[model samples]
Target: MTVLHEKLRGKDTGYWIIQCTNPLTHKRTTIRRNPKTDAKFKTKRSAQEFELQFLKSSMDLNMKFSGLFEDYCNYLEVHKSGKSLIDMKSRYNRFFVHLKNKKIVNIRESDMNLIVRDMQSNGYHSSYINTIITTMKILMNFAVKKGYINNNPIANYPKLKVAKTNDDLKFWTPEQMKQVIESIPEVYKTAPDVRQIQHIIRFGYFTGMRYGEIRALRWKDIDFNNNIININNHISKHNTERAGRKNGDYHQLVMDDDTRAVLTEIYENHKKQPEFTNDCYVFHSATRGPYFPLAATTGNKYMMKLAEANGLKHITFHGLRHSHASYLISIVGLSEAEVADRLGDTVAVTSKTYAKFFNQARVRAANKISSHKLGF
Candidate 1:
């Protein structure tokens, strides 16, 4: 039932009355709303949405968000890696705490919008908010599957639109990389204690490896004869070595001249010290333990500081991998399969990620072929 008040006591007044009955339980519910305060519940369209959501949530007192989210986390634990589970648990602690005790049916599109606004206003990136929403939606959809709720009300509401094209990617050009590297103080580049930072940066650009994968590297993992650098594991945020890369399999980066030269420099620097062994981390942080790789934060912090000081564009540590992929696709013009082999993704996945670059390549190819003169 919908009712709109036109007047009260001869003064102009407008408000909405939402009334509904539970089909399953024969329970009556009514909500009176003033458009001035509750914008989400003001219009007839949104009033009906509120009616449906409130009725569903009121019907079942036990379908709580906390309980359902815990169930979802249990499901994720069995499927996701430990590190990934920890990350999600952190998100739960940080952002999802407020939603914990609410009914599953109570979560709404408007609520999600509020969350997006709050996160954005608090300086959270769209990508980071995307992850939070993705995790939340996974729980909501799972609730629907388990019959905990009638349906996910927020299902149709799309996420914050994020730019996905090459122009939006934050990769650095080859020249920018050179400028940032060269701007480093000479002593920082020469001293073994600090040189690891520069070496790690160069190594990441030379071979498109994730910071975790690069940090986890061992001299023994490198096979000079086979021309392969095996990526089999990573150093977790907790400083413990974990097995298997993010892609869930062993990947190899074939050694090109640049990669070989970078490795040669790293090895020469390491062999000068007595602790150097095939078992040692390839990028060791002397400030920490010689046995431990640079804590993921160290490299990231250095990059931020270096960027601020040098007037260089802040290419995130992960952007090094993007730089490598962009260089391979747009500069070297490698096939998708070739890039995938180096990047450790399937060709289809790689093509979708770098679709803008691939599209440009197609245009260039067509133009080059069409330039051939055909005399009639």
Candidate 2:
């Protein structure tokens, strides 16, 4: 009943194994079946029927690797955020291309390893290569759960090592940020995009919200009386869809007078627009409708142009969040937990990321202590 005439056994042989779970003990078991005859089936459907009879289970064996990928994509669309779904599709597309026409049970760790090496040789960053490998591992695990493959082919696959340094985490100085924001109006004139970019930059600097969070802002999310911003929605990078913020949850932040002022001005202007509505995005494209958000590329490009024009050190739009955190911890004297709350991160992550800035604060305190004796 086997469709594949190729006898594949052991871990090295490229063949798919059927994975099933015991109902009583909840333990997983793998079943490998070989045909009695050397005849190869003409159609994938016949092979599936034969596999079902041999295993005495309803799990279909005719699913191609590509077909399994489509099911995986469907799973992602339901369970994952829009950004994560987009990222997975982009990475898995390359993997599908490499493992074309192969059955899910027929893919081996060696095939995955070859793809990893190829990606490495293509000059991708170590972090990115690791991500690609991780994507494969996730798919294989999904296949196992769906009873297509018995085990994860690259479960033991090693991730490429990524180097880290202080300089790798880029942030703008307070002075540089001020200069860039000030120069935006002069550089871009009276365009609606300039206003949107300015507002996004100011929001990032003061609130430490991620790019997606800021981009997904809606008029209704702003509470003018309470001076609070309800971060309940996020627009994906392509501006094609919306979802919960990066953590798949909502967050709230109290706004300062300056931030409230900026929002007030924008809201008033928004009210004047013909397309303005309660559900309108806070930052929208100049050409697109008012409810639509701007694309990530366009926002980043505008920020970069502003930095270059103002003779300031260039940092991506996300860098503004880091800058906000650094200023809050080092200059505003906020506690690590408070900063973490503002940035939607744990205290440990905030401390580790801004350890250098915290050290500088300690040095300043030491200088003050040495300069003055205790009055007691």
Candidate 1 regions off by >4 Å?
Answer: 1-113, 117-125, 130-168, 186-194
Error of 1 at 293 (Å): 1.1
**What would the TM-scores of all predictions be?**
0.61, 0.63
Across 124-222, the per-residue lDDT of candidate 1 in tens digits comes to 878889877887788788877655577788777777777666655677788888877786665266655555666777888889898888889999999
What RMSD does each model have against the real structure? Answer: 15.6, 11.0
- Candidate 2 per-residue lDDT, tens place, 1-376, comes to 1223343556526544444543223456544443566444444455555565643343334556666677777888898778778887777676557675676667787887788788788887788878787888888888777556567777898988886655667788788888888898988896757777788788778788888888788888999889899998887765645656786588888998778888888898899988778899887767887777777777678778987898777788888888988888778878878888887788887788888877787888899898898878
The positional error of residue 113 in candidate 2, measured at the CA in angstroms, is: 5.4
> In model 1, what is the error at residue 181, expressed in angstroms?
1.4
